[model samples]
Target: MAEEQEGSDAGSEEVLLTPAQLIRSLEQAWMNEKFAPELLESKSEVVECVVEQLEHMEENLKRAKGGDLKVSIHRMEVERIRYVLSSYLRCRLRKIEKFFPHVLEKEKTRAEGDPSILSPEEFAFAKEYMANTETHFRNVALKHMPPNLQKVDLLKAVTKPNLDSFVFLRVKERQENILVEPETDEQREYVIDLDEDSQHLIRYKTIAPLVASGAVQLI
Candidate 1:
């Protein structure tokens, strides 16, 4: 019988998923976040589940012989998972630091029932980052400026992600009628069907919705 792992969705519904499936989800989320130009929605559930698994494995390892080959293998596996988890989080933090103002604005203005793009902890980090950034700006340059020019608009100052940038991705689900924009005046926009398991190099903006819906995976 297949083992069941406890998990939850954004809607707070409890779901059963295998450990392997959970890791695959994390890997997909990591890759998508790594390649996407802009920040994507938070996968806190997967992160938490993976962290919990790591803790359980560490606890089990504590009971095993230190030099056992099986122990060593498990240790290495744990390390690999930790690396992926850390890298995923670091990628997100880098994006958050790069675009904290816009991130905060999005969080603030999102509809009441909509899911948040940042986890609660990430939200806190973004707010703190914004505060420190503004303080640094004021002390380093804004304070020295004439009163009329002292005010700064962070949204205008910080550059947003280039949605038009090209990204490599593999289709996870068959999608029909994806619109591809023209490159030049002579070229015309056209629609194309994306077959499942097919890979393509395309503009991020053109398939961003697919990425959000898990219909495509960034390669």
Candidate 2:
């Protein structure tokens, strides 16, 4: 069929940064950003790679402009690439937002506890970028949005009375000398164990520091 030949012809032409490659690139970017928290003074190399390939893809798209089917197919593929990029950045943004306090205090803090991980340079960049991003989210993304849609930025969302609930947590790090609520005046108890999970009737504020320090996680 003529359509089949057209498809074959288009497929024969080399395309830049296929969807799989783009997805992989984004994943690598996320990993680098996460694991190399101390070296984060540099922008993500993965993001740079993706943007370069994206530009190449855009050029190809321009060349394929006359072919409706080719353009359509390429558009769909491009959308996929954009989605991966957006999802990667948003995920990073969410983590950064959640740990904004840690970022402020320590350049490289663990997901659970107070020991620092980021170098001075990485911390400065992260803190500045996060502050700007949060401002943008507040001023643009969440500003004047519908009431129901307003809670999309969960990090900045105001707590509702019904929103509080009992949670299960798994301990992942040790916190020394933490004061426990009950058992009267013993004052300091090594309250948690590594890899031990427990359920508690508590508020977010009660465990927020633990969660921030990578000492505990909701399970």
Candidate 3:
């Protein structure tokens, strides 16, 4: 009976996550700001604040700026974090349902179900976690970007006949996302917006007005 009880306990356990581990993961994901040596040291503390805000249901991200220290918080990252968290929540709910399927059935009968019971604060926490993940991915991309972009015709730059062969040209001066436009059958133009993700120079294009403007540069 004791062995059976121990086995059951192991089967029903939830994995435990340490505060330190959580903080490290979160810090790695939301790191988009420049800092002095002293400031960089304080990231652990700032991450703690984020963790608390999430635990208590608060939205605490600062609006990113474009300049000396460029940081682009992609919306897609936020969505990815939310997606992973939502899946985790569903898995937990499924486990709960297995033990108490009646509760889910009853929830379905109600106007709003158990899933609806999650607080806004909880959702915010999930976003925080995702933001951390995004920041980490961006940092990894930056280290590998090419120093120079060559033979990259303004026309071919945006149209990018070969997506796989295309290189990402980051605009350190502007701190923005690249805007691509197709001017005519012969040419394409691309503009880098300083407010988008700084780590990757996205390959894309727009049509027409680009040719008329004419001015282009590699930065």
lDDT of 2 by residue, 67-186 (tens): 598789888888878776776566556555555554454443335533343434445656787667767777896778886765454334422222233445555564455443433475
- Model 1 weakest 10-residue run by lDDT: 1-10
Give the C-alpha lDDT of model 2: 0.52
Q: Best TM-score goes to which candidate? A: 1
> What is the Cα-based lDDT of residue 206 in candidate 3?
27
TM-score of 2: 0.38
TM-score of each: 0.91, 0.38, 0.21
Which regions of candidate 2 are displaced past 4 Å? 1-22, 27-43, 104-126, 129-219
Number of backbone clashes in candidate 1: 0
Tens-digit lDDT string for candidate 3 (1-219): 001111123365443345445443443323211110001111233334444534433232344444423223444444455554444344433333232222223333645311232224433443454455446545765346674632223222222122222223333244334456554679766664543224443332221112112212112
lDDT of 1 by residue, 1-219 (tens): 123333234455466667778778889989999999999988887898888888888999999988899999999999988999999999999999998999889889988766678999999999999999999999999999999999899999998888999999999899999999997899999999999999999999999999988999999
Model 1: residue 35 alpha-carbon error in angstroms? 0.7
The Cα error of candidate 1 at residue 22, in Å, is 1.3
Top lDDT hit: 1
